[model samples]
Target: MLPFVLSAALLEVVPSGKVPSSIPTASSTATIPTVMITRGQEQTVTPDWSRLSFANLPAITQSGSLNGQKWSAGQPVEKLLTLGDFQDSFKLQDLNLYAIAVATQMPIKLVKLSQFKLLAGQTLADLALAVPELEQLPVSTVKPLSDLLKSAKPSYRLTEKTLPQLLEQDPTLGALSFQNFDLTGYTLDKLPGLIHAPLQAFRHWQEAKLTDIPGLREMPWQQFPNPPSDSSMSGVIQLPTTMSYRLGKDSTSISGSSALGYQIPCAGCTSITFSDPPALQKKRWISGLAQWVQGGISDVAQSTTHSEPTGRNVFGKAFKVVVTEVSPKQAQTALYFRFCQFQQQISCSPYAIGPVPFLSYRNGELMPVGNLEIGTDRSITPQMLPSVKQILPTIPTEIPSTVNHWSELLSQILEQIKALLHPPATPTA
Candidate 1:
């Protein structure tokens, strides 16, 4: 939130002849009026060095009083000026007018102008003369920008009527932030003269509801001090010629030669295009134990009578080798491969395989069919090993029907994982 700092105090002086004869006179000390004139709510004034030490200390406190009694003691007049006339009479020398005017002009530096309260029907011209540096003027009625441009302030924000006027005076004034003003009814023939000014940043211009910006045929390339390295300026230059002609060739910085060759350059000088990975890579990987249960590949059928197989090695290979019976540890590896392939096909291949669990198989004792011994002289490739560390939960001695359910769940999990790894693309009808 913007801080609002109050400016100097205001005093309403009345002629002494208006004081009633019935009023009691001061004896040893002087008496001061306690009444004050207020436009809206009465505001409290904090004392500063100058105001605190003033001779009329009593009058200072009464100046901010809400009641009009302060002026009652002064001479009566035939008529009193309205608020507009009073504001019009404002002189630079008057401390009240001077302070408020300065406050209105440099609002960021000095916030609330407590002395001057704008009444209805006031225009920007009225405020501009008093506060020349003011970038904004909150007025009740919309007025012409020509009145505002009579002074050289960079910006002004008001209703719809004033926007065209503002643009007419200075189109290149960049960085406009406005709200609730409708431009739909107006026929915008062209953009303003100030469009050539380097517009570095704009806050909410894209969100605005402007139907036509006839001035913006070509892109504002020079506006950004440093554009993105891969940005293409061609589309910006090829905008409708109707919009271009209105902007005027002189008003836009882009030249015909530059617009002709605005294509972005890449490593191979080829236009970049993106595609999705093959669907076959989406299939799940089975662990050695799961593979045995699902009958994906038979351990007994593929194994040869070699050395003795024993202990944990016997059970480890029994569960893990296929897509359906895969363990969580092996499932993670398959998912990672599928994800990488889907995003960057060149980096991943269809030949990719998950880790093979090491287990022991013996002939005599309940011969753990489909299980291989850990110490067996079997060759493995670096590419076959999981890229990441395998985090295995306590291996279940008994396989359950729930394993199939888990496999189906893995498909959904892989889909979510893939979405995070890739950018959103247009959905096919």
Candidate 2:
């Protein structure tokens, strides 16, 4: 019936008096003696052991002859459990907890451990039925009990009503692992402590501010459909250079009907593919690519008519991207681009990049993917030239930008190619 309180101060609450020679001290080799609690009166004790001070445990029950050895309180609990009668007892979770408490030097009501053993694998409600004092246990005792029972108990479907009371009982439970928890209506201001839960553990938390979640800001942002309210293009990987593109059309020869067409046959235009695309709407890329081109081209005359997703089956599905630039000097340049879902079959082709890492565009530099080589002049065939010439004059001349001559554009492009193909020799002293 001794209370479970384990603190060095618990031993200091002795009746104020002169030191008893019978009681042990710091250097004494005397055996520890127990103090009896008188009915309706307080009992006092003092710590007189070495640095290792623990509560004076209640008297051992059923002493002697444990697994062919004399069982006593002096022996370690682990050895007693390992090679003692408690082997069966150790299997019980409640006893395991009591063993933990005893091992950790936490004061425990040893007499109650047997009762806990009887209720092992049973619910807290079941334990409360027998103990009645279970609810009244102090925080020190309750925490370990909660931890032991956490995995055993059925997952709690927490709601606004139940969450506060559960957290009030033990805030550490906020971090407990729960499968498929949904916090749809919660916000940081409303449940700040809930941040202890992992960001990925809960669902429908898109309502929460992205900045509020730790590590979320650093994740690679993909152009997925139905993004969170705070989602922005700033985090998406930017294409380093607009010059990454090359002019080449679909190489596949198709004789398919338009109504059932799966591939767009552009003999001399740009053909591109986005392999393993993220959950994205075509509009997101269209807007993103337009902004990228405008930003990269300051003297932009006009960027118009990026094609829609046609059932072009070159790789899988394709979208046409057309960017026509008219300079101040009446010279017009156009890029015909085809973007598609890169399929596995494309990998068999000699020109194919093994896997597409990323897709985005910027100004003045080629993209770093393996397949950019497909659109270079090396892939252009004689049949593509007439189609290229036919598409040239049809490009709109309305938009105007600072005009660089064709020769200058070609020279800069060649320099970029030369740098990629042949590195400058390292200077040595």
Each prediction's TM-score versus the true structure:
0.17, 0.19
lDDT of 1 by residue, 305-378 (tens): 11110011111221111111112121111100000111121111111111111111111111111211122212
lDDT of 1 at 91: 12
Q: Show how many residue pairs clash in every candidate, following the order shown.
A: 26, 15
- Candidate 2 local lDDT, 1-429, one digit each (tens): 111111222111111111111111122212233222221232222112222111221122212231123444233222222111111111111222223333344333322322222122333333233333433443233433343334435564333333334546666554443122222322222222222232222332222232222222222211111111121112331221223232232333111111222222432232232222132111111111111110001111112111121211111111112222212221111111111111231111111000101122233322221111123122223432223222212222222233565334434434433211111111111
- Cα lDDT over the full model 1: 0.19
lDDT of 1 at 125: 35
Model 1: worst 10 consecutive residues (lDDT sum): 332-341
